[model samples]
Target: MSSTRLLVIQPSRTNPPAALAEWLRDAGAELDVVLASEQPLPASLDGYAGVVCLGGEMSALDDLRHPWLASVRKLLAEAVTRNVPTLAICLGAQLLAAATGGVVRPMEDGPEVGGRLVAKRDSVGTDPLFADLPWTPDVLQFHSDEISSLPAGAQLLASSPRCQNQAFLVGTCAYGVQFHIETTTETVLEWAAADPEAAERAPRGGFTRDGLDQLHEDLAETWKPFAQRFVRLAEEGPRPNGSLGRNLPLV
Candidate 1:
């Protein structure tokens, strides 16, 4: 049998898949990355085992400025409707929420930047992708806008004091996370330099080279296995009962 092929939609040049691409490939899935800013999104999800939409520098509502986002949103909606295993990160998460009737707006408290922890909700006890995560897993936050409300029928899976809609599940297999589990230190530093205001909002000492190195180390511990589990889910596909197969081992 061929390896599982996942469609990775990159909404921004700055926020490439980075470490997430390595994790997915390490988990044995073949990736086809579509830089949405430079190319068209696939009209259908056909022949793709899963979809992974990465974060972007733009707001989810910036369709006029970045028209390709409209196509990305459409594909995401179709992913949910078809029950394809999907993971949407950061701005991608906001887009997922917006595309599915949830609301997105500028965070009133200001941008959430740097490495932080988000507590897992009880609903994750049975979620195929989140059940195995640590109680309060380490994550990287660097977004100005927030998913103020989740899409109807979406299951809230994780949250933090700063952002309520940190992670959520749509339908059976679509997952959206408001944090960054995929950034390398270099990727974040570049972001910081480009958006100094947002970088300044980061918690004091959050952007040091040592700090970022340790942050990625912590992320690899928690999210690398999570990525593998996602690849397994993609490989297994949806079950006859219209569910993503088997809950992840909770231990």
Candidate 2:
């Protein structure tokens, strides 16, 4: 059998797939990373078994500043329409929501930064990508925007106190998470250095070396298998009629 082919989209230079690329590769998927800021995005999802859109520093609505964002949103929409397994992270998740009839805006409470926990919703029990995750999974939160409302028919999977749309599933295969499961401690420190104000909003000791180290360890323990399961889902291809044989309620 051949390795699964996944398209990884990096919307900003500041944020790359980083550890998530390694995790996906370890799960037997071949990644084709597109730096959307520097490269042209594919016009279609053909030949790709899955899609992984990484985080970025830019706002999902900043098309004037970053024209390529429009293309990225189109690509995400196409991925969902075709039932291609997709995992959109952070800014990518915001773009996915915005492209799919959902709303994205500056977070009302403020930027949610630091290592945190998001409780899995009951619907996640039937989700292929999130079903096995612990009740509350550790994740890195570094975004200033939130998915205020999900796309119609989108299934809520996990949520945090500050942000309700922590994770969601669109259609049968597209998944989006508002947190970072792909960052290394170094990656987040770079984000912090660039945005001191947001960094300040993190919980006490959240960015300390000890704290971040433990957080990444916990993330690996919980999200690595989730990534692997995503690979398996991609390998299995879309299910019949795009249904998993369970009723996932819409939000």
Candidate 3:
């Protein structure tokens, strides 16, 4: 009777700093949310079919500033080792890369914001995630840093002008998107309100706080479908017997 449970390891308020909760609800997921900002990530990361690590201001490499970040990285590493599917966004993506020997670098050109088109690269035919979506998906973007390289044995899927390593397939099934496809306009305004720097650094012609909040209802409806697309990608992970679990309704 219940759907696949998603353990979201976010490093913000329980209500969340991202629209992750809203989008996951729309994806037909049963979210078992745990804010790493509130509690350290549980050591045992099993029991869930999927995991989602949401973005935050904290860098994955900065243990001195945020010790919980290091613990979360370990949790992510363990999750992948067990073949548990995951979707890592922004800092979470960087963490996935770093957990597998990749590096996160500050942008030479600075933060990328607003909506941008992501072109499907070599993964055009192979990757289940972007295979069905448009060849050039107009996805939301936000981030100052970028991943320089992928984790060992990863495949590049999609990219933008500002970030070359925009999306990647780690080993199999697990995917990471640098851009925030799940971000609703409410999340955008929340970030701008809480972090004044975000308002100033947003891409040219992007919205201010009031304008961002006003777009919440419209963006909320638009982002959910894209987030569900990601859910299907994760559900593609191989099972112990070489078969996947049943798909949940992503209506």
The C-alpha local distance difference test score for the whole of candidate 2 amounts to: 0.87
lDDT of 2 by residue, 73-158 (tens): 88888777778889999998998888887889998878999988899999887777787888988889999999999988889999
- The lDDT per prediction is 0.88, 0.87, 0.69
In model 2, the runs with Cα more than 4 Å from the true position are 241-251
Worst 10-residue lDDT window for candidate 1 reads 242-251
TM-score for candidate 2, residues paired by index: 0.94
lDDT of 3 by residue, 1-251 (tens): 45667888877651252576666666667888788877756777667778888787776677887877777777667666666777888888888888766778888887777666678886557555567666676666667889998876778888877789988866555568887755656677766666566556665655665655544544555456656865655555533421222221110
Give the poorly placed runs of model 3, Cα more than 4 Å off: 14-19, 194-198, 201-204, 208-223, 230-251
Candidate 3 global TM-score: 0.82
Clash totals for all models, in order? Answer: 0, 0, 0
Supply the global lDDT for candidate 1. Answer: 0.88
Q: Name the regions of candidate 1 deviating beyond 4 angstroms.
A: 239-251
Error of 1 at 61 (Å): 1.5
Residue pairs with clashing backbones, model 1: none
Could you tell me which 10 consecutive residues in candidate 2 have the lowest summed lDDT?
Answer: 242-251
* Residue pairs that clash (backbone atoms under 3 angstroms), model 3: none
C-alpha positional error of residue 11 in candidate 2 after TM-score superposition, expressed in Å: 0.4
